[model samples]
Target: MINWKYCIIGAALVVVLGMLFRMMFEYGVLIGILIPGVIVGYLVNNGYKNGAKNGIITGIIGGFIQGILVYITIDLNLPPFPAVISYILVFALFTTATSAFLDAVGGIIGALIRDKI
Candidate 1:
C-alpha cells in the first residue's frame, strides 16, 4: 500500500524547493529539508498506515536525491579512487539519515494531528 505518486511528488518538492532555498538564503540545507519534510509528512499521512515508515521512505528518497545534487554541485574534489567513493557514501548516509529523522518527526506530528481531527 505504498503510494508511489505521493512519494515522487515529495521527492520532486524536496529537490526543487531544496535547491531554491539553498540558492536564496542562509541555513538553506535545514530550511530546504524542513519544507519538503513537512509536505511529505502531510501527504504520506493521508494514505499510509504507519507515519514513521512513510516519512522515512519519503525522506530517504528525497534526501538521497538532494544529497547527490549537492554532492555534484559542491564538488569536494576528494582524492581519486576509493577515497572519493568513501566520501560520497558517508555524505549520502549522513544526509539521508538526518533528513529521515526530521521527516519522521514531522510525519508523526502530522499523523497525530490527523488522528485528532
Candidate 2:
C-alpha cells in the first residue's frame, strides 16, 4: 500500500531544498531531486513491498511541483494558446520521468539496505 503522507512530506522537502540550493548556492536541480529520492526511498522501504512504485509516486509529486515552479520562473513568452499547454505537458513529463528514475534507483538501494540490516 502507498503512504500518501510520506509522499507529500517528501515532495515538500524536495521543493524546499531544491529552491534553497537553486537560489542560495547555484547548485543544480538534480541535487534537490536526489535528497528527496533518498528520503522517499527510506520512507517507502519501511512498510511497502514495492520500493520502486512508491519512489515513482513520490517522484511524480515532487517533480510535478518542481516542474511547475520551473515553468513559472522561465520567461516563455510564447503566445497564450495551446502551445503553452503543450510546452507545460512536455516539461512536466520530462521532469517526472527523470526524477522517477533517480528516485527508483534510490528506492531500490534503500530497500536492499533495509533488508540487509
Residue 22, candidate 2: Cα error in Å is: 2.6
Q: Candidate 1 — worst ten consecutive residues by lDDT sum?
A: 40-49
Worst 10 residues of 2 by lDDT: 43-52
TM-score of 1: 0.79
- Per-residue lDDT, model 2, residue 1, is 68
Off by over 4 Å in 1: 46-49, 76-78, 113-117
lDDT of 1: 0.73
lDDT of each: 0.73, 0.73
Q: What is the Å distance of residue 72 in model 1 from its true position? A: 2.0
Q: lDDT, candidate 2, residue 8?
A: 83
Tell me the tens digit of each residue's lDDT in model 1 across 1-117: 456776677668777887888899987876777666566556666633466666777779988888878876888565888877777778878888887887777667666666666
Q: Give the TM-score of each candidate.
A: 0.79, 0.79
lDDT of 1 at 98: 85
